[model samples]
Target: MQLVRWGILSTAKIGTQKVIPAMQQSDLCEVLAIASRNQATADEAATKLGVPRAYGSYEALLADPDIDAVYNPLPNHLHVPWSIRALDAGKHVLCEKPIGLSAAEGEKLLATASRHPELKVMEAFMYRHHPQWQAAKRLVEDEEIGALRAIQVAFSYYNVDPKNVRNVAEIGGGGLMDIGCYCISLARFLFDTEPKKVCGLVENDPNFGTDRLASAILDFGTGQASFVCSTQMVPYQRVNVFGTEGRIEIEIPFNAPPDLPCRIWHEKEGATNEVVLDVCDQYTVQCDLFSSAILNDTPVPTPLSDAVANMRVIEAIRASASSGKWV
Candidate 1:
């Protein structure tokens, strides 16, 4: 099989910490090139990650004829513009989430994506593609957790630094945009529908003038979902699904490694079972999927449309938080 050549748009921390490593681990993927604004940084990342080529600028890497896709790990503010640029350059783009700061922002990007039927553009919500997540969806659909009625998810990590993007307001910074998005996305995924209502709260960071913590409640028609997302708490996360008959619990749901699964707790009819699964490096799985999609003309499952709904809920949450009322 011819490998799908990948060109990373930036040498960002996430590229080093998770994405690049995952790409290197996948057989169908090849890290052909990486670009940093400065050639030296690009060269350093290329050398460290064993990528064959490095470019001094984003434009140069996008123009590489051999590169079929671009993995955009750029900052939140750069995601939309860079992703459209990648698509315009005739390269498929797998962008990191949240794809945009607001629903309209996502819509604009989707408009650009509409022009590129030949190219795929998607947000990199790796968890959605993980096997365990597949299992979770199956379990819910199979009636293991019959008649889903509620979902509770939390994704939070302490962000003591005010200068980082997570705590800045100007560059689309806030806990909601940075990480709460995972909770918002996952809830809707399990429900398999857009939320009907969104209401949320936030704890402010005086130093940065950004929301350090955010929590939201969503009504999904048959079930109600509540999520607490933060950049100001001790690290904590969970994704729990409840039905009429039983419930399944995931201890570390959102950012779980595909190899290290969130434990599942099923309880019903006076019986309880504990399931421990291993699902680590979903990022690699995602990279492999993107690579194969581009190389084989296969449809990429998680496209911009998948993320637009999530962003709409996020926008509503921000609105709810600001207005101190339901949205």
Candidate 2:
């Protein structure tokens, strides 16, 4: 309970470059091992990360009694199955975002977590742990932005490589599933309500068989959220919230740089103010938070139920896009 012994599920770049290092930097987490399908890959990752152990197969890492938890950075399609396997092996899990392909799959993950109530299972939406987002939420709740009205989110990046897992349809690749989920989760977090209806427009890559661009509107009854996400557009990301008498804008909404100051701009009545937060590594905060939750038997910031709610909206968006009708 003093320190959470961690085992990484893969040698994914996200893990090797970002999440793992962030976790390693936390005093509450000790990344003891890393695994990859290829032994040499795992060994190399372990050496590079200063991890003491390496395993050729994920099962070997899961079987290690020393590892109390796992960081599942596997492909989107492998998330649920491997997370379930980890839970079955008595290890807590911090799975990557979009925890499941759909709401039904998310429900299954929840059911699995329910059976192992002692272990903590969380979706790795690292941005939620960032101080800037926390500050923005506090300001919104304090009504500095007045009554909430609407939210606009834009997240895109140009990546057309057909060989990348994100561009493959069979592995659950799409702009909505990849980056759009952030838009949905953020809207839900700010409004503190689920969307009553949703409408979407989608365009797929003919050769890749995955959605490259998408626009969606989420109706929250009292408020609305609109977003555009693409895998083949200029690199850009931002979020703006409009209220009855004021508005707030997040200069670096998603995928914020860990070393740069985060800014939140607020405008009200004829006055404008900017709040600056010190640079922070959100992934480390996320890991430490989860570790504390496990050691203290408390709740994680983003639970499996939250993942289900987000996935529900995502499913609705897909439905609306396909049927050419609001869903």
Candidate 3:
């Protein structure tokens, strides 16, 4: 089996502490190098993670001829620009989501991607690759939950450090962009369509100028999805899917632990059935799938258009919050 050589763009916690380790475990992925703005930082990360090479700059990593793909876990503002650079350098890109700061920015990346038909690009929404989600999708399709009617998601964590990237408003740090995007993405994923309209309520932090609490209702024509996300609450995450006859509840939806079994509950006729999925790293599954697509010249599981669509919903929700009307 040919492994796709991967270069990481940053030592961001998600990459170094989570994604990089999982990618290292994948049969189809090779963590060839990692880059940071500072050579010493890059070198330290490389030494710690067992990556083969360390580059002082992202450009140097992208310029490597042996690197077949790039995993971009840069800040929200840098996602599009760096991914475009990687594409221009003839490397496939797997960028972390919300793909860009806005829908227009995402569209710009889409145009860049269109110009490179030979290369593949994908937004890293790893939760979608998990078997537990796949099982939930199948149950909904199989009518085990009757007719899908609504989805309610509550994702929150407590973090108020002013220096934390998530608290900075200038570079796309907010509850919505950070964790709420998952709610929007999963709703669209399960509904298998974009929302017709959306209404939102956001509460921004006075000091940080970023949203600390947000709630929204997405009208998906056939059904509705509602979600609330927070940056200053007890750390909790869950997703519930409701139907005419029954409901399905996902436990620990977004941050499923790789070492523990994941479970979802199906309720019908006053009885609940618990379904548990075997342990697996979603990050490994996601990276391997993208690498396989590149090696086999196949379409990515989630397209760039999906990222743009999800961004539009996010923008619309913000607009609705400001205008006090559904958008």
- TM-score per candidate: 0.96, 0.99, 0.99
Which candidate should be chosen as best, given lDDT against the real structure? 3
**lDDT of every predicted structure (CA atoms):** 0.85, 0.93, 0.96
Shift of residue 87 alpha carbon in model 1, Å: 0.6
Where does candidate 2 stray beyond 4 Å?
none
List runs of model 3 lying over 4 Å from the truth.
none
Weakest 10 consecutive residues, lDDT, candidate 1?
Answer: 253-262
lDDT (tens digit, per residue) of candidate 1 on 224-260: 9998877888898888889999888876666776455
What lDDT score is found at residue 222 in candidate 1? 90
TM-score quality measure for candidate 2? 0.99
Ranking by lDDT: 3, 2, 1
RMSD of 3: 0.7
- State the lDDT of candidate 3 residue by residue for 152-223, as single tens digits: 999999998999989999999999999999999999999998999999999999999999999999999999
Candidate with better lDDT, 1 vs 2? 2
What is the total number of backbone clashes in candidate 2? 0
What TM-score does candidate 3 get on C-alpha atoms? 0.99
254, model 1: CA deviation in Å? 2.0
